[model samples]
Target: MWDLDVQPLISSSKWLQLHGLKRNKLSFSQILSQIGFQHREDFVSTLGKFVASRYADGLFPQYLRAQDGRVYNLTAKKELILHFVDCLTGAIELYKQRMEWVTSESRQLFGVIQESCITIVLDFGTVCRAEFDLCRDALSMVLSQQVAQLANDIIFSTAQDLVKWQQKAVPVSEDSVESAVKWLWKLEHMPAVSHTSSTEALLEAISDETIEAVYYFAVGDVPKDMKHLLLQKVSNSPYAIHTVSFNAREEETIIFLKELSQLTSGRYGEYYYCYYDLLISLILKAIQVGTRESLQRLLSHLAHNKKIKWLNGGRELTVK
Candidate 1:
């Protein structure tokens, strides 16, 4: 048995010798210790390289289990892990790029519409849900009091309306024309002590200020229970409501948002994957035509055959 052990030790020593390690003793433990140390050093170096490769390639492994239970070569396993790391790295970089692009595009779009005196009603309750940085950046571009007031009013009204609608047993129509006519009549002829006192405050605030356009940035779908009531309030308003739905997927939600815009004779647009592109397009169109066309069209319907020549186009347009 001693001889058998000695023979294997000698064979291992010879193998080490072949690999350029000159050893005099045929001790199994000593040979194994040396080999193990060298192997560990090699493994650490290879691991560093694998990490670097993954970072550079921006990828990572999708699966750890092989198709069959057969043993894989150690080198192949390392390569697979490296590939996975590469994919993960790539995905992160791409996301950063998209966010940067969106920010830049939004800034540019806002710049174009800032002087248009457009009242942008940013729905903090929806999709983007009023992310701080995004809202700050957008608000920074426009310094109009009307825009600021509108933003606050929309947010407040959304919350207040949701609560009020939930408490009330009355039913509101979703049709734009009927809602608008009824609401207008109520506002013009009715007393301020009516049930729509809160709505009257909102309308009075906006009407008192000169507003060219009302852009509603919907981040998500409105709650189903509040849809009809909210729509009635929005449609009844005198201001044209331009609804821009972002990242909305539900068919009913899309239709509802679109219908609101249509009912108010406002523009409706949807942005799924690229919000920046959609916003840029909307702003560009607004800049090209100017809000004068919309104002004139609105006036034509309300005034009915009155020849209205707009003097000093540079002055902010106000609907009285």
Candidate 2:
């Protein structure tokens, strides 16, 4: 129900007045500016209106059912319309708060952040990117809850997103370290003994540029070249890799853990997560405990002790 005291222009037959509407001189943008007063406000208003109209009569704003034209009447379309306008208006209002930081950022990190996610996730939960840790941290500060924990989720999620985008990345012959690291994130199965032409091709395509270490998240096996090289080449901390894939019978699991352990001079135990039964639930538990203190200790321990040269160029990305 809407207020009878406060009326909106679109509440009644105001729709009739604008049905065949064609403003003579003013451009749509200009009209939008006038209606919403600010560009951000206008943007939110437009989106909100569309969202609300779709679910105008629903008990909740997010879930809406369209009229079948048989069972349902035209209903209170104005309620839906007004709902959207208000919703959109609210989005802009809150967005303004975040923009304060967005405006301060030299890099338009917020803009670069996909808008589609802001409502679905970021509005309430934590999010992370290269340097967008600040927002997650800010959310925790604002809520006074486990903000850092949320940051971990964001980092993991963002890393996953980066992996998703790797397929489109044009690999370089030399400086393909970034792509290599990203690709490593996407791999679910380890390289089997089968024809690994695709995996080899992916590796050969990696440039000789300095790559500190890469995170290879695999469920099954790793390549022979990788497995042999990782285990035999670096022997300082052997259990490091074993810890990660404790149950990893696959060669790929052996390789990832070994390489990571060697990369961190046996400090891979910091990031290593092993599971006996369900690794999915195990990973979730790992995420919850990965705090700033834990991450710093893990990284600092790795950074201080230099056993292998691989970790020298770029430090392994810890849970932090």
Candidate 3:
């Protein structure tokens, strides 16, 4: 006496096949991994998509007409669909509970990044005041106050160094080895008030284990010798260095920073006034090494939410 609408199940089967999932063999575990195993909420959200799709395909009718034109009870089919839905829900709930248990046991583990230290190197020597403003604005929006305070402590001296170097009698050419050595010495030994010794001090202050990340805000060309020395130190450090470039017009500088990011497994971003746009770019870069499945999930979510518009007849993502 158990019966249900056959049409919706038929559509759901077709939908599963269209998505390359074997309908007959579908399981909660498979679905969870497909969505994203790292985040329980994402798994649940994706499961909701399948549920919605089945509902949209008319999964709720109480009766159905067979191919033979005979009216049939849909109670059994409804029960089956409900059972599957319940399975998905139960799985997500169980996973969520487990996550809660783990979180409770390791209360100090979560959000520990906020407690870590990050060094921010501001290239004030080459960057103009306008560029500095942009850097400040971006940092204010993206960084937490604690992190900002850490950055501020080191940034003051680095800025002052640029000003001191600018006022010096000797012309410090970008390629001068003598100038590079002189500034490098100043950066290491000079007091914060005498020179912008922030970089060396920042590097010295952070141990390989204590430092979380390094942010280099570059506005203009970096001297060849200084760049070499900085890159050497960064390579030896355990943490990655993320470079944010502002109005970097020099070809060599751009290439150098880009290569530095790539070699160190760090992120490189060009500062755009639009923080959202910049964030998206950074996210894309971070996930460039992820699996195709991950990319597909992201794209599907973006498409379904209408956050991205398709262009070139759906072959391209429209820049909005």
Candidate 4:
């Protein structure tokens, strides 16, 4: 049965009623979305409060007698806490695995691509040789990983004109990925001149009805005039246009890409070279410190680790 006394607290809470929740039926994602938390620290704080309240009310000295219809002894309370800790630890490990997968390699770049048959447009208009190479490497990783885990086509534009890897979407496999990577390397020797007709690649990609979506990977900032034109052109695309911004020098690029993606009912991802650098550094540190305590110390420096504080809020975790 529901706790009758808590009804008064729920009814009195303006914040709770404001959410329009039908007896707290919201999922974790729904709650976060409704709360619209702006900072990671704020989320951590709120989560800490939740854990603290749950323990204080249910399993501090003993489980709540009214809720369970019997007072749980000290031993029972200890067992319950341990079980809860195990479950929480399992959830954390699962979340960590997913985060590692999502942020690994070109997953960050092509993670938004969910369709089996899709088209990728590479806008290497503004990057130099080094930047172009970086873009190529990232794309190679995507082809290797095959974020969509199926067939796909590629359209890339240089200064001269647009180029296509295949006439239609090809299945993602070991041989196909190797061939695509080889084709990508061939472009390295070409002059990295600015591609003026930005919309040409997009137009070509959309022309293919077999594709389910378009991934527009842009390395540098686009011109204001072209941004407006591209936005107008892609506003009514048949497929979602997921925009990826890499090493964007201008705030306008991020804003425009986000706007474009939102307009096309697509997702957006922004990446920087520093992200890989930081990731590499973290990996190296983990390798250097193989012990559990050292690993925890290393992770403690990360902002995400602030979650550990909340997950163990007001609980003394004795390692025995």
Which residue runs of candidate 2 sit more than 4 Å off their true CA positions? 1-164, 167-212, 221-226, 229-256, 263-320
Please write out the lDDT profile of model 1 over residues 1-320, one tens digit for every residue. Answer: 12221211112234336422224322433333322221111235645642212231223222222544222112235565465456546545544543443334432233122223444444434322113234434444332312332222221122223221111112222332233233322321111122343333334334534555566655445567556665667676676666666545467878988898788777676654323333344456557778986445444433431222222445533223
* RMSD per model, one decimal: 25.6, 23.5, 21.8, 17.7
Tell me the TM-score of each prediction against the true structure.
0.32, 0.20, 0.37, 0.59
Instruction: State which candidate has the highest TM-score.
Output: 4
Off by over 4 Å in 3: 1-115, 144-202, 205-209, 274-320
C-alpha lDDT values of all predictions: 0.41, 0.30, 0.44, 0.61
Cα lDDT tens digits for candidate 2, 1-320: 22322122121233223321232213333333333322111235645642213333444223112342111223335665475466556545544544354333211221112111011011111111211233333322322212111221111112112223233323232233333334334434222333333233223222212222222223223445655553444333221221222123344555565565565453222111221122233344447787776556445434432331223235543221
Clashes in model 4: which pairs? none
What lDDT score is found at residue 68 in candidate 3? Answer: 40
Cα-based lDDT at residue 69, candidate 3: 36
Candidate with the larger lDDT of 1 and 2 = 1
For every model shown, the clashing-pair count is 13, 10, 7, 0
lDDT of 3 by residue, 55-83 (tens): 32333232323444322223334466676
